[model samples]
Target: MKLISQPGPKTDFSMLLLFTIVVLTMPIWLAPIGAGYPDLVQKFAIYGLFATGFNILFGLTGYLSFGHAAFLGVGSYTAVWSFKLLGMNPVPAVLLAIVTSAIFALLIGYISLRRTGIYFSILTLAFAQMCYQLAYSVLTPITNGETGLRVLQSDPRILDGVITSQTEDGGPLITNFFGIDMTKTWETNIFGIDVQLNAGFYFCAFFLILGSYIAMRIFRSPFGMMLRGVKTNQNRMNYTGVNTRPYTLAAFVISGAYAGLAGALLCVTDPLAGAERMFWTASGEVVLMVILGGAGTLMGPMLGAGIIKYFENILSAFNKSTLEGMLGFLPENMLDGTISVLSLFVGEGWHLTLGLLFMVVVIFLPGGLVEGAKSILLKLTGGGSKKSASAQAAE
Candidate 1:
């Protein structure tokens, strides 16, 4: 397996530029597009973090954990409880979420790692389901059942440094900045559009960039190579005097922490911790993101997360009226049926689109979009050097 190396100056420089552009200007692009803009991007960032962390276990360590939602739920609950009891100081809540998630992972991993493959997966899934039941019934007072948790004015905002509320006029009563109120709308001109830029979005974007950077580094490290080795051959690794158990456990814990961080970030945006996020489907969806993007690739999971979340939020928003507007250019006889056909794969039934994508990807392109991109790059570069071909053949 390969280890992390310096991304060449050009690649590193390009990544820096890309980060600056996206993190700085996403608000501008998302604002005019509709309210879905900020929230959609936020979902991508958070889920990307979640998927990247999951990849550390499933992609690198070859451990399929189906109960990861337990950590996400744990994180979400921890953060929400922090807001409820401690205060709305986001930093503590985020940190507590990470720590709480880690503890859960450590405990769960210790037991689940005893078995490998399907048994391990089933164990994790059972444990997660156990947590779900506990939250639903046993932990009613803490989890607050189906209603979840929400912010209230009566709640203390200690460490909030500065807090603001929506005004009667429908504008922010106090502008969001570094604990400072601008008392003015937060925006600047962008391409003749009044972009509603705000500090909160930028703050979350910063975590997105940080999370991406961290994942990139992990993908390139010696520990990463060892994890990959475990994925490839746990038995072989053990015989070679390299213990795979701790490595696998570490990967699981780290992934759980990432999910926790994402859960906390989600709360920061909406300030609500919904129990529904703990559902197993949410865990499976993140796994889909990793598989779609190309497991074991740095950018693949993030790209996958973005694509799936985009479809969920943006594509699913399409309705009959919107379809009719576009189809107005077509002949009336052709319009209705065509729109109906398209609707089966999108809008309210968008999961059908996702399922199909997953099927096609698994059957035809097992390595996923990143692998597909690599194949194209290889073809463009003329089938690699003779020495490289020989080396690959040897492998």
Candidate 2:
């Protein structure tokens, strides 16, 4: 009976600005505290983009797609193709990838949109599985089969005037961008800590910032409101003479483009596109990210992506030495067999921790980490006065 007004441009932009400061400065702040934990920086950057785009679709339109990794794989393969057939300018590669993903989303959306709810999810899942299998078999020449598509010493450098990849020295291959070699690292002091920065991290960070900004803008747009309406009540939206197909299709395409951008960033950072990325599980993980961070919240999915990626990269990186160090406070004699027992749960089996976290989030914080944060803030800040009583569903 009552509609809550969305934030004005001023409030929306203020929120966006706050998020921008946190994202851009987080690496700098956490760099020293985390002991050079930049390895996951690009992963967060790419997956954050993926989850943000996903929010546009699942978060806004309430379409729970289980096969979104198809778009990511398509974008990555497209980028790798650009590197192989076109050039390494990055612009063309990225554009081609986005377009490829858009086309795929259009096709999938046209077909899948015909169904609703579980049917839609299943349709998308089937398409994604088909893509995974095709990449593994039907497109061996392009996809390179199970081994995955990768840069090779003999692969043609179409963008380069020369025929091969070169090195710093003229005698060897050159893997570079413009005149700048990408294989080098830049060491800088930040907060009295040595930071070994690299071009790839910066490149991915640019896209992450750009993607987050765009998502924030979309969240504030009138069209975004319509999508949220569609999400809240599609049947009513249709009864109100609104064409839900076009809106849902648009959401799908935009989300697809986001996934594509993330994929291009992935290839740019690693210079490879693997079939494993297309796995159905990969698609499911993005869904987990959105849920983990609280769907329909601007910063939630990014936070969710950061949490999972941190666990995957950082927690998974821990091994015997880490366990021993952690248990060192105890007597050395008591520390024996502790790491081996711990190894069963972590180290290589770190996904167990992720699963437990997801379960906890679902059970205790049904709205996910963002809801948990709000509740904690409500308790800690002695209740936030600026906070809205109504939950803001990010479009």
Candidate 3:
């Protein structure tokens, strides 16, 4: 393994400017894509955080964890409990979730780091599975069993002066920061394009930007250099008197905290945390996102996350009628056959599409969509460097 790839010297503020532009204009771009709704938009930010954080460990240090979702679930449960017992304000909930998940990651990572390669992966998977089972059964009092944990009407929010489960609109109590309601949205129809922008999404986007900045700083730091050293050759680092375990453990904890933060954000957006969030498949999904987007690259995970969320929310909603409208130019029998074939990839069968895409990425674009795009651009310009291509491929 080549560890994290340094693509080249970056121009000052170029990345920052790009990230800012993308974050600021998502509502406009997503509107045309039929995913301008608040919930799906928030998901893009939350999962972007999760995948970016996972990349810090897996991409930089080559540690493939199959138990990161355990931290995400822990974060969710902690946030909900904070709301139920402390207050509806999300600041304390987010802080508590990060600290709690960090401690959990420290313990789990310490033990799991005793092994490397496949053994390490299995250890993380086992820990996550144990957490899932515990939450589902033994920890029912804490996790609320399979029904999951949610803010209840009768709970006391000690920090806030007034605590009511029902708002004036008679809807369920929503999360807020101070007096700014997280669920409040401004809906607009411009030229027949419906757009819904919510405060919750902006909140999540702020954190996502913060998280991306932190990840970028880490990637450029000397500490990040040490991590790549550990990934490339741990035994050689050990021989050179460098302690690799601490570095790996710290990365694991940081990644876990990131996962926890993502979970808390999920709760902040919807205020529901289910035991199912801790499943191994949830962890696998993050892994897929990292690999599919070009792991080790800053924007790759975010791109991968956006692709998955778009498919999950938008593509999966396409029914036969929607397909017919898109394929209206076809004859009746031909349209029906096309819809039947396409239906296997859209709607409830979106997972099949996801799987096929995953296979294509693995086979043809091993460095993922970003690297493939880079290769294409390099070819078009007739200035391709083999060394740069290899570095991009390694990522």
Candidate 4:
């Protein structure tokens, strides 16, 4: 297969700039939607990074892995341990998490990449489940079992002890960047709306931007072209005396590192690590995020992550009382009937709504939201004619 042409530096800069603006301004734009809260926005950044990393493997190389959550969990555990044994400086925790996760990914990818297709997917799922079980039961000493891992006052924080004073009241230490507490927020009134610009959210957003730039560079690199070739026809490349295994393995490792960074960010904000993060469901959720946002595209995964998180945080907050207030103008009987049906799709039933949305996207917009959006833009701008002209000329 021929190598894909790389995008120009100017194009890359413009795209990166636009992406940065969009992410940094999320609080301002999302305030009206009732999703401007710091915690939820932090989740948006963390999971967006997770899905973006997963896309490097699944999107580029067509490798469907079900064990990425294992790496994420590992990153979190490592970061928390860094806090317990080392210090609360997020820089070292993040760096150590990435390195440790990369190593884990290397070992896992080495074995898992031996198989292809369904077998590979099954192997990943099995490995992730094994990790979850170990963290939950077998590795109780390290993971703290179901109780999860957290920084404790009793733990020996050698680095913190050397540089900082002990807490006067002996409370658990909070994670921070150079003594800038992550949990602190700057709140203001924006056009009658309460907007909170959080330190932790900005911290995650910085990494998200960095990760996106790295992913973009990889996507436009020779290595990325090789990965796309592996996805298109591994056997053909093999026939040409090329070893595709290393390429796929490298992609897997890089993707794992991205996941690791995300997990570390999670701990940086919350300072806790749990086996639940390694569950198969978490892996599956990232897959959905990548697909829903449009795999193989730069902005798709982040968009998907935002949508899913919004639904999780906002839609799932609805209750019978909330619905009654929203529909109070209707007749009592009709309102009750409406609540009965709608209630089944919101709150605890939000998954049903997500599933329905997934089905609609898969059946009608196979390219996901990205494709749906492109189609709409093409129609509005009469861009279809330009695309047709190019195709006809090529033919």
Best by TM-score: 4
Q: Give me the runs in candidate 4 sitting further than 4 Å from their true place.
A: 1-7, 161-166, 328-334, 385-395
Off by over 4 Å in 3: 1-12, 162-171, 189-192, 331-333, 385-395
Candidates in order: C-alpha RMSD to true structure: 4.0, 4.0, 3.2, 2.8
* Each prediction's number of clashing residue pairs: 1, 8, 0, 0
Ranking by lDDT: 4, 3, 2, 1
User: What pairs collide in candidate 3?
Assistant: none
Q: What does candidate 3's lDDT look like per residue over 10-41, in tens digits?
A: 65268777887788668767888777788888
The digit string of per-residue lDDT tens for model 4 on 274-376 reads: 9999999999999999999899888899999999998999999999998998899999779888999999999999999999999998888788799679767
Model 4: residue 272 alpha-carbon error in angstroms: 1.2
The whole-model C-alpha lDDT of candidate 3 against the native structure comes to: 0.89
Rate residue 224 of model 2 by lDDT. Answer: 89
- The parts of candidate 1 lying over 4 Å away from their true place are 1-13, 29-36, 152-185, 384-395
Candidate 2, residues 167-275, lDDT tens digits: the string is 4233433235665554446778876776776666666777778888888777778788889999999889989989999999999999999998888878875668888
> What does candidate 1 score in Cα RMSD to the true structure?
4.0
* Ranking of models by TM-score: 4, 3, 2, 1
Model 2 off-target regions past 4 Å?
A: 1-7, 33-38, 152-158, 162-175, 331-343, 381-395
What's the residue-level lDDT of 79 in candidate 1?
81
* Per-residue lDDT over 146-224 for candidate 1, one digit per residue giving the tens place of the 0 to 100 score: 8887755555545444343323343322323345332223656778876765455566667778777776677778888
The C-alpha TM-scores of every prediction are: 0.87, 0.88, 0.92, 0.93
When summed lDDT is taken over every stretch of 10 residues in candidate 4, the lowest stretch is: 1-10
The candidate that wins on lDDT is 4
